[model samples]
Target: MSGQHHVMVVDDEAAARDMVGEYLSLHGFRVTLCDGGPALRRAMATERADLVVLDLDMPGEDGLSVLRDIKRRAPVPVIMLTATAAPTDRIVGLEVGADDYLAKPCELRELLARVRALLRRLAAPAAVPGSAGRTETVRFGTKILDLAAHVLRDDEGRELPLTASEFSLLKAFAENPRRVLSRDRLLDLAGARDPDAFDRAIDVRITRIRRKIEPDPDTPAYIKTVRGAGYMFMPEGETR
Candidate 1:
């Protein structure tokens, strides 16, 4: 990881963009400001951004559209910003590949912390390289999770679509197989350190991951949910 991470902020409102970008800059991040999707595209064409802070309610080509494009082109981490507290809004963003989200009028301190946590998540794998603590791959059911490549492929080597949050959550489960993980503990392990990020968000990612790796998502055999506790990944389920 570099000494200063480059973060691109995309918001329609100038005030909102300036406020967020300036705050991130003050916290030792190199900030790039863009008003909408076009500017973001142009900036991305010239230089790469370590992560993106995207606003959901932009006029033309909303945040979801931009997020889709970003994932298609580069697949960098994203933290969505929105004014609405509606669960649906955040869930939609997450489903569309947003790594995490923050509601409007957010505390800069919280955003900074979230940014640091996300960077740490991205850096953790690199720090271990090929040492004994590093995982090359994890097997479950018929799917093979490439931890180094950050991908899930089937028996035929068909890659699946997995968002950053889902990948992080799945990795956490695989690393601590058969041990019950409370929602709060899962959040910390998944690099989601924001108080505003609800535990239900973890449930959403779990549901998404279950669809990919579980034989039957409805009755998940890999990531089983304890009635009163949290989730536990069944280590014995690996067929390979």
Candidate 2:
């Protein structure tokens, strides 16, 4: 990782653009501010960026559209900012591959923390030697998950649309193949601070994921429920 990271700040508000850009610049980052999607695309074409700070609400091409384009064009880390604070919106953003998210009216310090966390996660070395450059795709039962691209494809090769929480939960299972991970451990991995608030939330996400990946969601084949424990991914060779 370079000492001076390049970050693109995308927001329609002038004050926000300046504030975020200036704050990041002060922290030793090279910042570029864009008012909308078109300007952002133009800037991206000219320079490679290490990260993107994107606003969810925007005129013309919205932030989500821009986020999709970014995922398609480049695998740069993205930290989404939204004013709504809606769980659905947050889930959608994560599902579509955002590295992190911050609700609007957030403290500058909190935003900075999210930015640092995203970058650190992106820069972290792979768990195994030679795994860094390997494509991160996991297959279970009738579904395939592309971690790098954040796409979930069914057995028939159709993409399954998932919410952010669902995607994150599924990814956690896929990465730890065949391991029984408890709710507390999962909350930590998902970056959620309150485990109780997210207790049934993870269950909901898992059920949603099972609907997409399982041959029979009612009696799930891949993601199995451990009666006394949490959840486990029963890979082909693993016993249920």
Task: List lDDT for all candidates, in order.
Answer: 0.81, 0.74
- Candidate 2 lDDT score at position 205: 60
Top-TM-score structure, candidate number: 1
Q: Evaluate residue 180 in candidate 1 and report its C-alpha lDDT on the 0 to 100 scale.
A: 88
Worst 10 residues of 1 by lDDT: 126-135
What is residue 9's positional error in candidate 1, in angstroms? 0.7
Tens-digit lDDT track of model 2 for 1-240: 435689999999999889999988888789999998899899999999888999998888888999998878876778888898557776676556665677787688887876776565544432322357776777766788777666788767777664444556666887787788997777666553322245554565676677777778898878888887888988753675
Write model 1 residue lDDT over 1-240, tens digit each, in one string.
435689999999999899999998887889899999999999999998999999999897888999999988876899999898777778787767788888898899999888888877766672123446665777766688888778889989998877667778878877777788998888877754455556667777888788888788997788888777898888646421
Pairs that collide in candidate 1 are none
Q: Which ten residues in a row have the lowest lDDT in candidate 2?
A: 122-131
Quote the positional error of residue 48 for candidate 1 in Å: 2.2
